[model samples]
Target: MTAPGNQAVTMNSQGTAMSAGPQPAASAGSLRSALRLWRLLRVRDAGRSDPQRLTGVLAVVAFAVTTAVLLLVLGGFGAFQQRAEAGGPYSDEGFYVVLAGTASVLLLVPLITLGGAAARLSMARRDERLAALRLAGATTSQVSVMTVLDATVQALAGAFIGTAGVFALIPLVLPVTFQNRPFTYAELVPEWWVFALTVTGVALVSMLSAGASLRKVAITPLGVAARHTPNPLHWSRVVPLVLFAACFAVLVHYGLAGIVVLVAVLAGGFALLNLLGPWVMSLVGRLSARRARSVGTLIAARRIIDDPRGAWRSVGGVALCTFIAGLTAAAAMFDSVGSDDPIVADLSTGGLLTLTIAGLLAAVSTGVMQAGGIIDQRTQYRALHLAGTDLTVMHAARLRQTAIPLLAAVLIATAAALVFMLPALGFGLLSSVPLLIQFLLSVVAVCLLVLAGNLASARVVRTVLA
Candidate 1:
């Protein structure tokens, strides 16, 4: 309960002096101590450690991207609402409202996932220092609180930058017309409360993710270590896929009964893809390893086989984005049919917009996850370099690790999406050159974006090895 200045040499709130006899400290008292410790080490750690600096930069960048995108998506909601109000209760503005809502739902999960990736990366980069505190007598809750506090600060900075990002992006988007007219900046802006809520949500997700990650690890005097192996992923993951297929079939068998049903099916199916992704990843890894012809491929395959969940985590956003592309590209294809209706014309623009935004989400999150993966295995990478492993081979292995799951996930998701749409579009859907072009363009763009993400982390490998 005493102030930090009371002791000859002040210790943290826990009174844990790293001595054999350490006194217990209250949680509230730990805040000053944690802040003091953080300030003392921040400069030294940033200056001395490559990973420390990189983690901070990545965390801020990720939070900023997440926030900016959240605002952009929310703007669509607000724009549609404003348009609806201007129509005096008798316009097809409601139709656009439904489209905007659906697109927002598709993008929301990936945005939060990106924030978690940022938190996970930032939290991990500090494990050594945190474990040192644990050794010096900090309790689990204390270390966790410190971790959350660290993430909260990073999140706040990121959100501020992200708001700025939205302003910066507004001019670029101003030329794009919806409802036959371009949007003013004011029209694109959401309600004032939306900004506050989004910033708070981003911070909360970061803190929660950082605190939760600590629970999975055992930080002791010895080192930062994970506990026993997690229970293996179960076959029950397939349940989602089955449920998705059944729902899709029902929507197809019946008719265009309701917008609510369509959104529910789409959202449910998207959620299920995440569950099915890891299991599918494991299956792909096992099969590819058996047929591997090169050392790089074998290593990559082995990695996926060992931790398929982590493998999926790296590429899940990209896969989900691909599904979005598959679902929306049909609307764009309809434009090629030369429909005169303004709504039909707008569908093309909306579809392309959805694909572009989803692609951005995939790219940013993939880069962060890839960087974090490399940092997590820096020691292993160093050992491989020290051994006879060639630089080319290491690079090859890293590329293969991402390339394999990304290819499988995209192809399967696209195929599933196309199949679900068959009840509506029929064989014509598959045969349309415009749809084919849209899909191909999306695939190429996604591949390029994913490759860019992988390339961004290539420097991180060298940093880790050094």
Candidate 2:
């Protein structure tokens, strides 16, 4: 019916048309596949912007710092030991290293973890990003879990890095040899179990420290911003303080208390700062507000009352740091005043008082630094002023609020000494004053350092506020 050439051309044209028509559908299918891949990758990207990032970053940095400190401590001790065996002039130098290193490590870890947790909570309370998580259907528990997880991951990584770094750096700092040959640095190669335990312990502490803040998130008024408004300090601080006071009283009366008694007393004092410090600030805040001629003081007072927890938290850090420094100073003083000295012999005591004070103070210093964030929250305070608070009154409220924690910490340190020494040493308590005095001076020095840090923080905040 048709010529062969025409038929062939017709068939070829039909095939070309069919292929072209399906090309668009194929391309669209490919596009959809690409889009699916992107969607799948989104989960991975989501974690980067999480509130937990702060915790993670902190953990990493802390790990590095801890590792460095550990290395310095170990290396110093090892070299001291080596030098002593060589009949060097500093034969007893190894003792200092052991005392300092053990004290530094044992005291530092818990304090750092506690402080880090408190600071992180403060940040979360202030940050809108955390609020956004809530809006996105994340429950308080989910947020808290994520935070802990991030801390855990970072802590684990950090511990590993820190241990390895310490092992590596120790050799550089102090070349300890064995039998005229360098000791093989094995077994000390970043113990996985140590990293696991350290990181886990730190994360748990941090999470627990954040408990109050997390509760706030869970119970925050619906539709209100998750930003904490001024409120009474949480009651967790009060009960513990009461219990501590009771234990301390018992210790004072008994004069034969053990380590358990000392721990209870110290913990109670720490609790009192959180509980009583906030109440004191709230009272001052109210008084200041009443006397205000303008709205600024009232607003500031309101802010102080509204966020008593924050103030208490910051004080905790200060207290902890002061306590640690005081302890360190006390120990050094004791060492300086040799036990065999006639004056020391007349005192009728051993190393227990000095060591106890140092250890307790170290714990207190950790708590105080956690509360340092309050000083960093000046902008938020400024916002209160802008919202109609008088600057002078507000500043007073802030100052008073801050003073409560510092004072509490100092008092607690004194109380800790009283409770522990009175029981353990009896009449020997009188002899403790000289060492306690040294501790007080040390605390003052550390407070000066904290104030300097605060001033620097204020300057930065002022610039940012401006």
Candidate 3:
């Protein structure tokens, strides 16, 4: 922010901007400048409401979950790679290593999504802070730096907590054996540089996510006041997914020709599901809103239609995990192959592990997202509560919001997994009793995990409304 015409702006050492009549502004884009601005803003927010404080707390917890899971996933990958290269009699020829890599790849999307969500958790508060900084004669660069710095500090705090969490988690994992050998803490821990890298990566992710939001919000005070409707999701979002599906079918028709192409297509197809998710969610919301016969469903559908991107973010992890579970749910059919190889048995273990962790990630991420949503809409909720509407209806609405998209996402993902795998595994596997049991258990566990995540926010809802 700069002086225009006769007005003046200056800051005391305490960081409060003063009407000191024309004076020089603080240097912009410096770390010191950003910290000073942060302090000034923090002071202004010192008297924040409980809901505001809880929002910050929830964001930090989300960051901690993200960091801890990241460390575990990377550590697990390193352990398998190290064990696979040891040239021992216990080696299954890098089989477990491949499984670990698959799990890591599958977990990366949700982990990063959680990180971004945590960074931008306090959206409404942040916009006000940004506007306040601009009013305080801070430049855009200074405001941007402060935003990133604020997110980085929170992530750093969470990273430390997450590091401590890893130690506790290692003991729990120690009891579970892979290849008849339980993991020592030493085996599960990554190298020191791994921790350093994880911290740096998290900071970078937070910064980038913050930066992206900065672009969306204008820096001017009036800009903050302006309300712009979110643009409707374009049909272009579905083009890539449709094309990918077409290519997949073409290959499937040719008796699965071009094995390398098949592998690439399969990987690309899974990626497209994520691309297609929000669009499908928006479509679901639009349709459901029209057909909604009850207040709960109507409100839930409207919320999704309002922010389909967010709607997907809350449940997207489960949708993807559900997709993975759908494919692996039929793993029991492999046991009937009657092979002497221990590798066959390990498949079930690996699938269960992947589904379990995925569920946990989805649960925590959903909880954090829902808590944040409650804080964001606290104003509306309070108004409604005062108007004699029951909070139970609101709670039911939120549950529907999560449940409906979850059903759509699961259906889309399951159909995709079945179609892709059907060429190789055939319809016979779907009919196998053991396969049905394992897959059903996997799906139920994930749904239960996500339901648990959604429920985690119920406490937050109560707090906000109260």
RMSD of each: 4.0, 13.8, 3.2
Tens digits of lDDT, candidate 2, 1-466: 3311111110122222111111122244434432333233223333422323333344465544454444444444454355456664334544434443444444443355343643353344333433444443333334454444444555556556765666665454224332233434442233445445554565555555445455555455243363435445444655666666576667667764554444444554555544566665556556766876655445545655665555454444455545454445444555566654332331122123223333333333333333334333545655765877554554455444445445655676555545444454454435667766766666665555544433333332233234
In the range 1-466, model 3's lDDT, one tens digit per residue, is 3363122334587657654333333443244555765777666554435455676677789888888888988888888888999868768788788777777877887897798789878866687656665565555555666677677778888888887788777776777667767777888898899999888888787777777667655334556645355788887988998777777777778776464565465457767877888889999999999999988899899999998989988887887787677656666467567866666666666667777788888888888888888887777778878988787888899899999988887888778777777776678866777777767777777878888889878887777766
**Backbone collision count in every prediction?**
0, 29, 2
Q: Which regions of candidate 2 deviate over 4 angstroms? A: 1-127, 133-192, 203-256, 259-303, 317-338, 341-404, 423-437
Rank ordering of all candidates by TM-score, starting from the highest: 1, 3, 2
lDDT of 1 by residue, 117-203 (tens): 888886655675666566555555456556777888899999999988998877777888877888898988878899999999989
TM-score of 2: 0.54
Q: lDDT score, residue 228, model 2? A: 38
**Candidate 1 at 250: error in angstroms?**
2.1
Which candidate would rank higher by lDDT, 2 or 3?
3
Assess every candidate by TM-score: 0.90, 0.54, 0.90
Residue 368 of model 3: what lDDT? 88
- The TM-score leader among the candidates is 1
Per lDDT, what order, best first? 1, 3, 2
